[model samples]
Target: MRFTSCCGGAGAKTLVLVGKAGNGKSATGNTIIGRRVFESKRSLAGVTSTCQLETATLSNGQIINVIDTPGLFDSSVEPRLLATEIAQCIKMAKDGIHGVLLVLSIGNRFSEEEASAFASLCQIFGHEIADYMIVVFAHGDLLEDNQCLEDFWGPNCPQLLTDIMAMCGKRAVVFDNMTKDEDKISRQRKELLSLVEAVVKNNGGKSYVNYLFEALNMSEMDLIDQTSEVTCSEKSHEGKKFHIKYEEQFEQLIKMVELRLGECIMRLEKQLAEERVARLEVELKAQAAQTKSKEEMIEMKERLERAEELSKKLEEKFKNAENQSKEKASETIWSRMGCIIM
Candidate 1:
């Protein structure tokens, strides 16, 4: 079913940048705002530890509100702390989220953590949130000369990254944050904003809002009871047909969203388990190799010790034989001299 926009109209639009740590979410946010509003730097962990909101007016007089969020799937961050950070992001975007820029770096290999990123987002913000997502690949400067973004999506590209782009309706833009070319930067910014605008337009000029999140948070039982109440009220008001149909559709949509979200969560859990197993296997192989090297060294040392003992024994035997020969020669010489004197 097509999703109708629930909030935010034309004028200022709000976009949220989300991804794993060190993926350049903060850098992307800064690029979108046309200034260094968010603190961005090279780090193993995310530089932006909290959600920060900044606004800027473009040359065309279009105002954009960009929200830079802490790393969503950072391993170093505690789950509770991550949840708190997400809550802060939600609070900052309470008015509505026009677009969710899933910032990623083109230079880095798409990892398992990145593969599970969307599923995790689905778990937190509901499956429908994918409708508002746009994939923004940072570090476009890493792209070879004369190579376009499409070049990276060849057969060698990670399937997970392709899947994410497909889920986001193939809406993506490459940003060369390190580029100093004014025209190039402007073109990239325009392309990104164009995609965002297209999403907003497709959603009937409305943004994804907290209301949808609240509705998704409701239990199936709660939804059923709510529908029943609405049905009864509609019947009393003599508008049963319209209200009943709408409520039924809405209820079904919620249930579908919940089911999809559950599946996403399960898939994410499976991916994580597989990653852990793979990591363990690598560690075990390294340990086994180390143990084999140590055993080989010990065996070589034992061989050297045995060879040394044999060498010492052979040397002593040679010395004893030489001394015996010398004594025999001396006795012969003495006998010869006595004979000469007689």
Candidate 2:
């Protein structure tokens, strides 16, 4: 389905930046944004908890929001922290984010740490988020000593790079922030603009931001049918009947369709979990803040309110993931019994 916006003037674009910490993700944003909007540091968890939201005006006077996310691969932090950060970022950008710029540092072996990070991302955003994400290669200077991006990724960093492309569905580019090269930056900007244009065109000049969500519905239905088929096949085989398999598949499909309504509850839960973290972070920050200006105080207050809302929502999402995990686990058991195929 295409998204069409009938609004006129001042189109807004939100780009969320993500990566394992210290991959020059913030620097890339600073370069494109032409300022130090995001605080860049050498530490692993520099961005830490997704609080920084910067909005920059492009040459065309269009508003571009740069959301810098925390490093998901820091061993010092719990995995749930990353999930919480992502949840907060999305929640804060309810105005509709345009794209997710997934950055990777050049020359590093895209490790399992990265894979796990990607998996959590997939689980958080699900399959459909791929529609709004583009690969952003940071620190490309490391590749200067080697061959091109393709050769370097193809030889040493094949698997992770391949997995990233698969997650992004093959939309990506390399950005060398260290170079004083206009051509390189221009090329990267062009790719970013192209992604924006494509999104605008495909979504009918409106941002579908969550349209990748369409795939999730299909995936769930597929899971349900898969479960039902397994059950029917096992029972039918014992009863010496094959016709029941199709009937079982049909019934399961219907049940899955009916269960789609329950997804609403799951979504609410996910929001609750996110809110909890956001609230805690805000409260902690508020308590620490000594002398705040009027604007800072208002922002903190708003953050507190958002946290309350998210806490309830995150609780719900956690419950949803739990339920989904159980459903998949049940299907797995059936699969082992030769009941569910696919």
| Best-matching candidate per TM-score | 1
Q: Estimate candidate 2's alpha-carbon lDDT, on a 0 to 1 scale.
A: 0.64
After superposing candidate 2 on the true structure, give the runs of residues whose Cα lies further than 4 Å from its correct spot.
Answer: 1-10, 42-49, 73-75, 145-147, 182-184, 203-205, 208-342
lDDT of 1 at 67: 88
Tens digits of lDDT, candidate 2, 1-342: 333233233677877787787777888787667677777765554654564688888777877777777775455665345434544564456556577788877745576566655655555455556677788888777775646778765655567668778767687777777677777676677678677667555545555434333333344456556556665448546344334543454444434333432343355457667879999999878866744566788999999999989997999999999999999999988888885453
List model 1 lDDT by residue over 207-288, tens digit each: 7865444443343346446556664546555455445654664555445444544566577778778989999999999999
lDDT of each: 0.77, 0.64
Clashes of each: 1, 21
**Each model's RMSD to truth, in Å?**
9.2, 35.5
The local lDDT score (0 to 100) that residue 289 gets in candidate 1 is: 97
Clashing pairs in 1: 7-207
Q: lDDT of model 1 at residue 116? A: 75
